[model samples]
Target: MSNNVVPAIINLDVKGPVISRHLYGHFAEHLGRCIYGGFYVGEDSDLPNEGGIRLDVVEALRALDIPNLRWPGGCFADEYHWMDGIGPKDERPAMVNTHWGNVEENNHFGTHEFMALCELLGADPYVSGNVGSGTVREMSDWVEYLTREGDSPMVRLRKANGREEPWRVPFWGLGNEAWGCGGNMTAQQYAAEARRFGTYCRDHGDNKLYRVAAGANSFDLAWTETLMKQLGELGCAYRPTGYMQALSVHYYTVSGPWRDKGDATVFGTDDYYRTMLQAARVDELLTGHSNVMDCYDPGKNVGLVLDEWGTWWNVEPGTNPGFLYQQNTLRDALVASLHFDVFHRHADRLVMANIAQTVNVLQAMILTDPDSGALVLTPTYHVFEMNKGHQDAASLRVDLPSGVPTREVESKELATVSVSASRKDGRVLVSLSNLDAGQAADVELDLRGGAVTGVSARILTAGELQTHNTPDAPDAVAPRAHDQVTATASGLRVHLPAHSFVTVEAALA
Candidate 1:
């Protein structure tokens, strides 16, 4: 720690972009039961499924107030042939999933199923197009199929497929991780291809498409620079119509080591530190990529989309590792809350983001039984539910007077305090997760221009750090309404619990 220097103060700046509720978005990929047994079935399942989409799952997601949903693939979207999904179900060609588990894709949950599911949840749809192994016509037609209302071949096919009205898909991705799973294409190649495909991506009357070019792998600033150079405002550039909306980036937290991902359900001081250390990278990737984008377009012409991000780890043992289904713990709750704070703080340059998988996949929210009608809420879900107040609210920068130490997870020197602010329905909501495990922090909030009248917190913590929900002990770790909060004379003093994450809502009088 520094003797003279104090903790950095975060300013709300009075005003900023209204945090889009969509920023608290989620993702669903074809990997694992994330699709087949997770969100969809054969429409004949006994486990409360509708049109193959699970009913309980939809209702649960709705409870989280999910704003937008990215679909089809993490790696799956790159090779996704959107056509095979439409038309008929039985006759649909069977495709093999090479990147993920090599399970033969039945193409049951195609475009129609996905759009309809999105409609059921009332969430905006974010579709990742195929740039790795797909063509421009295929990608363009997909936009038309979902958006165009008139007599285009794609639209006609869509109408015949079951949906009469266009979904008005608002978000579109040019590609998914082209540097890796997508196609192993160079940044320059993907950028040029992005322009070519993005140029022709027309929006049908009702549907407004925000085309995002495939972004760099992780910390590839060179790729971002090259892509920007090609875009150089190119004289009248794209179109009177919006050609490109955002440049995308994908990053996952693979802590300590990847080969030995350790236990997904285990947590200790070390686990907490490693998790926060890795999770904090969201902030790094944003600024690093943002700097590169600014060099090319100083005007901030393009939005940076963290389309895919979350804690990555070894899949549950006995489960197909390739499916990426893992357990979630209170540590995951803190990670989720902290990541949301990152996005809120960087809401300007970052217009949109989606957690990798919503259910039954990487750091998923809901874990369901493939056979039984049972479902368990993961710590990630509670984080989303608790921090939902930040949705669509203007971000107010928050600063703490002191710093904390992360002694457990190898970041013992200095640990960053996780905090983000948003105003909703006249109340200022501050979601804070102290990275320090088992050590509570006294947060003296200077609610400038506001008075702290009351505080309510919903916290997720457990008796044991590694305690998790198994089939038999599903409720072992869950969030409970907490009460160690009170208003103070100077501002407000709230005792944040140790190894716990809380969403504290302050009433500004």
Candidate 2:
């Protein structure tokens, strides 16, 4: 630690936007074991099952209070056909997942199964409709099957299939990555298609749908500009019956190019620093995309949905390369904390964001080993679990004193510390991360509006940057009670360890 470097002071004011619970959302694709072996172990499996869904995974996810879960994919959603996955598990048609591992998808976990899993986790289901290889009628009927109550063809089919009551699916994605895997269409083409698909995706009774249009890929400002401009023009000229409620963006932190995304667990300090810098680019991406959105929708009518954001790395050695199965480490915890801070800072425009996956995938929350019946919660999971208090809480404006640690690597500026705070139920919850891999931070809080009487915290840190939990060592990197927080006369004081994520809850004096 530099003696000349001043301690970071976080000033929190109560007047700010309310952090959306949806911001802490998660994503699940049909890739690898994320759905099959990760969450669903089949009804007949001896390893604890709830109608085929893994009970341990459900219990862990429920504990995190996961707000929403986007289902069936990254690129998989655009290729999925809702009809083939319904009816009976044994009779469902099997298709090759060309986008992912090229493995055969048995279609066992369909709409009903996903809804049942959501019910088990107490999470809202955000279904991504197939627009690339599917029809508008197909998309409409899928929505009707899940939300429609009255007599309809889809409703009748749904009832005949066994579920009498319609599941409340409020969030629907029009497409996923339309510019790439989703038909490779131009922005104008996708915008028109989005309008068409969204028009027929009706709201059943009180189930108002929040339709999210497939948005830009990372820093592709041109894609965002073209889509928003085309949508605006369409609305003005044709006065479209249905419009986009949100524009979805996808960004992942990779250490290198597409082919060589570095390793998930084996990395040094420099690699960790570089990864943090890449994750920090999310702020720039959000800023650029939001600025483009402001041009088309000044009132911010349509929110920016970061439906897919997390660290993507090379697959674990010896695993199927296409599976995208990787281990999560403390480095991932820092990345998650940094991203969450950025989301809260831009909560007004950034309505929702889902981490890349929930389990047995990129930056997964839970790692399941069915062979051994071992379920491991990653450091990333502990970050989400600790920061759960921020859900639906009113965001507090935080002003950090200048002179915070900043590094310039590869022409990018990365901050060593990331912070976000919120007030809910008369308790102020602050989440902080020390991105520095070498030095701990003595951070001081300058609270406004009221004095803090008591302080309690949970911290997730490891002795090494690559520290992670394996099946045999599941408790290796779990969160522990933070005893470094103490109430100060002015506000509160916290000792933030190096490369650590901490969540502190303070009660007003």
The candidate scoring highest on TM-score is 2
**Residue 495 of model 1: what lDDT?**
59
Worst 10 residues of 2 by lDDT: 233-242
Q: Clashing pairs in model 1? A: 12-397, 73-77, 270-408
| Runs with alpha carbons beyond 4 Å of true place in candidate 2 | 1-13, 233-241
lDDT of all predictions: 0.78, 0.87
* Number of clashing pairs per prediction, in order: 3, 0
Top model number, lDDT: 2
TM-score per prediction, in order, is 0.93, 0.96
lDDT of 1 by residue, 173-290 (tens): 8888889888888877887788888888887796678888888888888887777766665333422225677888888887768787767776556666777778887778888999
Tens digits of per-residue lDDT for model 2, 1-509:
23323344444544578889999999999999899998888999998898899999999999999999999998999889989989988899999999788999999998888999999989999999999999999999898899989898988999999999989998999999999998799888998998899889998989999999999888989888876775565232333135678889999999888889999989888888889999998999999999887777776777899999899999999899888999999999889999999999898899999998999989899998857879999999988999989999888877776657777777877888777898888788889888989888867777766777568888899899998999888887888899988766667777888888988898756
User: Candidate 1 — number of clashing residue pairs?
Assistant: 3
